[model samples]
Target: MTAPAPAIPATGPTPRPPDTGARRKVGAGLLDPRQLLRALPGALRKLNPVTLARNPVMFVTEIGAALTTGLAVADPSVFGWLITGWLWLTVVFANLAEAVAESRGRAQADSLRRTRRQTTARRLTGWEPGAEPSAYLEQDVAAAELRRGDLVAVAAGELVPGDGDVIEGVAAVDESAITGESAPVIRESGGDRSAVTGGTRVLSDRVVVRITQEPGESFLDRMIALVEGAGRQKTPNELALNLLLVMMTFVFLVAVVTLQPMAVFSRDFMAAAHDTAALNADGVRGIVLVSLLVCLIPTTIGGLLSAIGIAGMDRLVQRNVLAMSGRAVEAAGDVNTLLLDKTGTITYGNRQAAGLLPVGGTDTRDLARAALLASLADETPEGRSIAAYTRREHGAGDGEPGRDVARPGMTWLPFTATTRMSGADLPGGLRLRKGAASAVAAWAVQNGGTVPAGFDYAVTEVSASGGTPLAVARQDGDGPAQVLGVVHLKDVVKPGLRERFGELRRMGIRTVMITGDNPVTAKAIAEEAGVDDFLAEATPEDKLALIRKEQAGGHLVAMTGDGTNDAPALAQADVGVAMNTGTSAAKEAGNMVDLDSDPTKIIEIVEIGKQLLITRGALTAFSIANDIAKYFAILPAMFGAVYPSLRAANVMGLHSPASAILSAVVFNAVIIVVLIPLALRGVRYRPSSADALLTRNLWIYGVGGLVLPFLAIKCIDVALVQFVPGI
Candidate 1:
């Protein structure tokens, strides 16, 4: 006896218990109140102070120092020249930088909007073509009135307007866009499993869907909620880091404020002497004091921290993987496991009839004819492949030309969830049906005979190879049905899949294949595809459970699928990777969307993700290193002028106030310039080997950090000597 099937847990939230019938309401618009508050300050700062002053706080501080210096020079006119010159430079460069960054961000958003507009929605009244206001109106208006039998026209490459039943035509729809699946699904009418989603594309053929739900309440809206709702949960690491940065900034500020008074008092005392010797001494003291303040402030961090992340995001986009969140991209590099759908992802998704085995006295042709008749109205790659093979073998026309012997005089029985099989009414007593193998096998057993020996063996043999075995039979006469033959269905593996799987294994990523196909077939395909694990006969819930299990084990899981059934699991995965050619639901659910549907793209994206993380980490490390050095160099100087024994002289004229101000400005500018090249070069890089990639990053980040700061300070020293002189 077969073992009892395990109960599959629900993939998503369980239905609200009867008492809680009310639905939760959410507000519209992209930015939430808290996010807006956090972003606004940064945006304003970007526009005004930081961007405008080149270094706003520093510039203001320099102005104050210059005023004091003028007071000592006994030439108050010099204060006006210094402040005016510095202010003019800051205004020009700062505004220009802010404008350029904003423009780039706006341009990218515009391109995304353009792509969204290219798609049109179908209305119940008629076909709404183009991205005009009328099309949206038609969608909104008809969305409320749509009913069953309403033909909604979904065009090639256009998102499906609503969740509906396929009434006519066949098409490959990319549900991945919505469901986070990495493959396109071929949809047709007359199967309980066939479902069309709103915001998925009709890739090849025009399709008509019978509306199932109202437009506003459709799956697309739910998907939007899922994506939007996810933002509330902060990753542990993100929260920790944010808190750390805040604390550090606070501590740095306190140090600067506490030390500032001492430096100012020392300068005041020297000014009171009213001698040339005292003025020069004060100038030297001011330089050392200001340098100390600069060190404590961690200015280098402001230049490098976010730049690394921004550069990483740009690199991902260039590789055709649009990372919606920086955290998602970072998580992808550390992914230890991947949950993949069997049909479009692991295989080519095109089912074909491998062979047919005759049962009892049935001939091969008769078996083919039976399979074709049963599959004619069905809409699945496996069913279509069987029908096509039959037509090709018997020289029948493309259309269903012969009478359907099973269902005589049957007009229609649209496949419903209760039936599990489709049927038609013709004449006499006949019922044509095609569905799960176990169901068909049970029917044959009740008929008091077994499938012929050869046929049974063939079914078992194909199932062992991971091929779905579909039994075809017809009922003749008044009561019992005669077994005809069996059809073996198989999805062809895409080219280069084996090699890519091997590469992924080398990278220490474990691949898991999940499918609704039976265990025998699933195992066969898994072995062929080199998957580390396989879960067969899985419902949508089963797939999601597996994903959660892996994630709970501390593995960062990237899930790839292209169906409505895959959406929840995709969302649950650490990195939901949707195919560009998948349904809109999948796309919205995914963290990253690949423009190309090739599974190999996953490997490429993972590598890109790694590069991004490494680059960001390196940049952070460098920025922090510079911060440490600045603190060491300048903090002592601030205290030195206050302590008589610790007073350092400007013996080489290097520690003069003017020289210190000029050096800090030059140091900041050089660091920014140096980082620009690093960002540009890092983004353009492609690694041939993991070791080489790691080594290169280490050298750039590790060595560059140690060397660049000293060179920058030295260059500033040399330039100051050339411009200013003192004995």
Candidate 2:
């Protein structure tokens, strides 16, 4: 088997200068002092009952805290004051968890904002459509003044004023501000690489940009809003979990409310029987219903639920991906089928000119000149490679060795989907073209040129070897166009893809590669990349149909695309991750945007999503099991006075009833704060069978949760006896 090639950017390369900076780091530490300090104010503000009401569990805790505070003040006992203070602290700690998560995201947003400074745009005037002008009138204007459809000229070293498509010329753009990649990437007038972000800088040449976004509606604005938690909403799973918690809280509230009447009835019966030794009636009087209610509800999970959701989005942003909603991130965890583009996902995407094969009686040098001249004005990576190959093998004529300069009076013909060719119309009635073999052969036939012998062999050989063949041809005045040779463009499969696909397969995800390449080439590339399936000659309609078919079979489909034509299929997929550099239509249609524009980043997305789901699941198990142990610690203390034998239920023998009650509530509140870091960091994940994962969660969180709280509550009671007099 052929070894895979080293990976490059999905967008092809341009002429690069020396590196200016290293990759930008994403997100600060979860326990960063600065982030914690920033969160404190927000936490304090969230204490308002209106804001706390959004979380039913937390709201109930706050109400209980308020009731306890009133009772503590009226009765004025040491134990009452201690319990009231800890109850209020519990509400504050829950608010602090959510606040800390939001603060981390806010920090990321602030950093992004720094890169988007206001700049002036050289807006063009007197530029009529379809009119040929040597130059357009330039008007100095603020970038904010430029509206959609307005054209602006951005020169080298100038930041792109807004989100736009390149309408003319080609340039090397540095997108380090948003993508965190230091290498420069090419942005040309047409194709998938044409879309440029507002804050990226043009490092070389100039481009005529047609602004695509209005003020405050650019890609950067959307990204900032997402990272700052301004656009966060609960996912379907989160809503359902909250509903379950609310129901549990309601049941526990009723149970606690009925406990007081039962205590009164038990006391009356013992008094009538004159069994004074069996009952401590004073202990029944001391049972605090509010404390029992707070301890019983699922407070640990409720306190950290919002924090967990916020941290999930923050994790995606840290990975240089922006999700439009929490639902998209959650969906990524359950993606069963991943529909990937062949060019960038499996292969390096840069189809380079590897060789030249002459046809008929054409000389090697003659074919080289035609190919180089045809590619001189082409800015695509393949075009640049063709020109570079010609210059290196055959000497440059009257031009610099590394540079490509067009002759005077030459008209550059750019490649289009309809024409399927790019070339130059030279001086003195000479026309040169190079593109797909079929397109060039048809063009030659239309111009009265006969098909050259052995031309089919050359095209066949390139295609059979997983390479694209571009036929170079020329026409002079009224003379027929004759085919000269074939330019061999080979796209290499990316390295380590087989291994990555294997991992996905283990996780039960089916990988599919879709491309416009013919069957032989597609088959070879798919096998090389170890994908499960391949679809050759796939059009936008074909892609949409495939996604619909997968969904019909009850599969959750995920796909990555970066073109206007891909918008339909992207919108149809269960999880659509659009490249940040793609057209506005594609970006708007997808639910997530990959900042690095790496098609294979979806694999990483899947892992993050799984980690998020696993984290929530694990913490929930721990929270529910924790209540079991709290029951053992608090229940016996509440009723031991009513029945002497009930003291046996105090498995972790405590000094007194007051200490046990105080310890249980204290442990309940402190655990939320203790688990905040774990909630933010998320649970570690590995690709394994569902049964294995379920078994592991049961043992680690479920069993540990049931045991740890008993010891913690007992230790707290022992310490409370030493410090506090009443308890």
Candidate 3:
């Protein structure tokens, strides 16, 4: 037999060592801090200008007050002065507080980036005789020029420079930072069996690598991008709600602007023209009425609107979920439908051969050898698994055996996206090929033969249960083909998937599997996972259309994926959740990215989202309740109806102008202070049935909403009565 050809060259540029010495140290502290501080000005400029321009109610109120201030200066009316002063104070303080809060949030984000840069990069140099060059050499170093056994220096915590066999030393590397696995993987040198992650840390070992893969295209870079880029896309629900909120604010401002003249005309004109005593009394009453109207319109709702969202986002960060958009969390809570890509997201994305079936005159050993040869040049998880299995079965030693073999050839056809098959050319015009059963079966039928009975049986059995079925066949020099056997491959499911799926079901979410795999296999896995539905042979385009169909039915869909092909569907979903193990393109198309790549993180996020919505809903009710009371407090006075009949001494003897204004402001501010902490506490959640989670959130937000307003109002009333007794 011919010796196997050298491994295919890896595509992409070699990675350059990040400068982690002098400049990096300085940049970490001084440069990072200065950049963060500088970002504040830009952030402020971006936020304040937009908020001021877009928040019509605030802008109109400020503009109206300026006009009123000018009128007061010209006419010197006490009423104009009070209106101008009160409105200006409210606008100025509210806007300033909001700006400060947002700026602080941005500063916190900057700090996180600086923390990540503190870790150092390790670079390797040197070599050995007959050994490959080290991957950690400087970018300009040519691989062909290096002699064997040269010394290579690798830095601390830097990524491994290339795919290489280790020659020396040992280290505990944190591969979990990229792998989504929580534990650090241990690496040791001097063996053909040892493998290193390109970007992982060296910890405490000095080692030399025999470069296997070329420089820049290491798995480490791909993994890092997968983890970090998961937060790029905006969900449809978020986009819609944002537009709705903006429009609602606009409507409120329009009403305020149109009604301003009526308020001005309704003022006590006669009292204004009379003596100073009457004017002072009218001014106080006018101020009270305006305050009441402003309170009625739910201005306080805006204060708590994003409070729940921000709190939820903070909680997600704590759980290692970097939610890029607050709107994504909100959308997650409302997801009635979920679509999952089979690989990586649901399956481990690593395939292993469970068993092999033989056909015609071939035995299992022959089947294994052919499979191994066909897979020798492929580097996918499936191919690797086949190669490893073949070596183990054949009792091949750890290192490559020194056996000279001739090339068996007519022509070798590599796997491609279009063909979806691979083959090796043999003497006597025999071609050994392996691929999807359907494709191979079609080829068999076209060449005037049926697939062997055992082979057909094995394909039907494995393919029906979501297992990838690979069929092997041999075609003679210009005649028909004979079927060999089938290899059944399935992704190993994560341990906790069943329980997580159960929880999701209880939450009323209908889970659906969408995969490029055959329908037979898709259905089998869907049944095993307890999915509500399955779509087999789904392309990315098909996935997007399915998501739109579900959304059109009024179901909020959460789609999870981890490849460039999945980007469009992820972007189209109501909440796009990308795995930390996904491609950079997929990550950029997702609204939220799971840093740990745990599906359970999706549950955690959903609970956080529910808490946010409940908290915001409760706060809205509480803020509005306070406004309701404010309206009632000044309603009779505004109409001049109760002022005559119900004297102040009769009712609680607390009806003075200063007393009323103080009570309203104190009540509003106090409720905000007291409820903020409670709202922030929303709920502590763990993975559980959706029903149980939702019930818990409802109980907290509901009861808190009911009790807080009563306690707040009663406390304010009693305080008012004690502090200022008679009018």
Candidate 4:
């Protein structure tokens, strides 16, 4: 009787840590009142002309404010003072938006710095020829003193000293300080998960780490610098938008400058035609012209542009994604095709032996024994599961599984991409192998074995059902090699992927699965996971070629990968998100790092990226629309008394020219403060088509921008008429 299939034996390189980090909810704190207050002084400091000049529109506004303040001081009218005060407030409010964003970044940097506090490392000085932990000589040293190639031994409860690879031993590491994860992850000496970040704590066991980077060059150091905003430069889109704003400011500047002559001419004409008092009207005043100029330019968007970019990066940090540059974040927004690696991304990664099926009436016991001997020395998850499956289904006989199975003097062969198989040369010149069905069949034929009639059918049956078929074969001394049977390795598709991919589909992104599995298995998994397409039996070169091909077709690609072999393709993709558990090479190659190591995080990143662009675009539309409304408020007021017919264009009747112009200036300044929360929090982005998003933003921000300012300025005018006496 069978021994109950034995629970499938716990297998794999290492047990993946539960992703507790992604589930942790973080509050949005960029708009906290305390943060706003803390940012106020920085805003005041930014009043320096040199600092303010970076934004052309805002710089022009400051110049206008300075001009009005001086004129107000010289004349001292109630109307002049109010306009000047509001003008100055406009510049200050603009500076405040940027200050708040940078302040949050600096605060995040401070938190990271606390985690990176210097710790003592037990640096290895020497290692003896043994494999035991006690064979090494170690010395205590500061973490900063550790350099590349230096070896350090870390024990339980101690923080990892520097970014490094585990060269020996295995342990559970808590990366909560960096990844915001509370669970401990297994970091072993071999495989892609060998990389460990500095400042994370070791939870259990001990590992000998080889530092990969010098001081101030580790991943955490880079992350700290990024969050500090010291390395932030405007993205290409931001630069292009700034150029557009500068041109718009220039156009408005020219319109404002020439308005003086027009005002003088209108004053002269009105005085000659009707009354002499028209010559002395406030319309010709330079301060009045300056107020109009300030309100006409696109100050609203110019003020919040930097804030939008900084907050976008800050949002990414909050989501446990560290983008190396603003460009990568922006590119993520435009990804047309997402090339996902099938193993870790689309599926649960590890393939396990589900069963063994014998062909051509072969005895099940004979096939089980051959499979066990072939997989005994294999370290892959499938190999270990196979041996465990055999021991439970068959029997250990006189010895334990994987221990003293047959005889001595055996030579082991490990799996490689080229060979596509792993096996051993047993005692008495018997060779046993287990690997890809095609690979083993070819080897058996090469070794003069007669092909089993039902071999092809068994392999196809397993593969068509989304199972990898590993064929077992044997060659006895001086005799023909014969096929034993096929081992079924089952792959499980990750949960909720179909729904997530459907969301991406709605967002106009195509999801492609790339894997080394056979075509049948690839098709089955791809359909089950709901990917748009699949490329089976792909090599590393095939992945790179596919990225290039997609780019050639004018598609922007985003891909996630963790293996060192995935580095080149990751580098080639437009947005490459490397898992934090990936190798250092893969991490360095990719543009962004997912601290939570969730492949589906690219979906959130795409949303954040799109939101960044949407926020800037929506605000820009509102700002321009705002300027259009201001033209109606201030233009007709400036020229109304000089030309009576101009009063007809003043849609909102005002008590005086003073009230109308001042109301426009006040509305302009107050609106910047009004939208500060929106600028920091960003506009809500749902996955939809480009045209749909455009139409919605146009109706909301664009149409609303035009209508709201008219009512707001009119109300401010009515309030001004109640109190002020100058008019």
| lDDT tens digits by residue: candidate 1, 1-727 | 2222222111211222111112311111121234323333444455444443444333433443454455435532321233234333332332232233233334444443332322344654544433344544334334445554556777687777667767666788876554445677777765423567655677897776777665455544433332322222333443454455546655755665576576455665344323324234434444334344444443444443343444445555545566667677678777788777777667766667777877787777777766766765555556556666777666433444333323334553334456455433335666555556666666656765465666667677777877777776566545566667777777776656666667567667888887888787888888887789999899888978888888788889887765566678778988888765455556667777664545445656666666655655566567666654343333333334445443343322235434444454455545643454454234334433557656775677667776666556556657756764430
Between 1 and 2, whose lDDT is larger?
A: 2
* Model 4 weakest 10-residue run by lDDT: 1-10
Runs of candidate 3 with Cα error greater than 4 angstroms are: 1-108, 115-286, 324-327, 343-503, 506-508, 515-524, 537-545, 548-556, 637-658, 678-711, 724-727
What's the lDDT for residue 637 in model 1? 34
- Per residue, candidate 2 scores C-alpha lDDT tens digits across 150-211 of 99989999999999999888999999989889999999977887899998999999889999
Error of 2 at 727 (Å): 1.6
Q: Write the per-residue lDDT of candidate 4 for residues 1-727, one digit (tens) a residue.
A: 1111122342333345433223322224447888778999999999999999888889999998888778777666666777789989999999999999889888888888889877999998776434555776789999999999999989999999999998888999999889888988999887889999999999999888999999999998899888877778899999999999899889989987866567465555445324223224353266777887888788899999999898889899988899999999899888899998888777778887778899867898888888887876676777887877777767632352343333456666766778888887867898999988889999999999877998889888987899988999999988999998999988767677787788678879999999898888899999998999999999989999999999999999999988889999999999999999988888999999999999877877887888888988999999988887778888777766566688788888865666778888989999998898889888878777888989999999999998998888889889877776544
- What are the runs in model 4 whose C-alpha is more than 4 Å off? 1-30, 124-139, 260-284, 352-459, 469-489
Q: Candidate 2 — which pairs collide?
A: none
Candidate 4: deviation at residue 242, Å?
0.3
lDDT of 3: 0.56
lDDT of 4: 0.83
Deviating ranges (above 4 Å) for candidate 1:
1-45, 49-103, 112-242, 260-291, 310-327, 351-463, 467-492, 495-508, 579-605, 629-661, 677-699, 724-727
TM-score of 1: 0.58
Residue-level error in angstroms, candidate 4, position 178? 0.7
TM-score of each: 0.58, 0.79, 0.54, 0.79
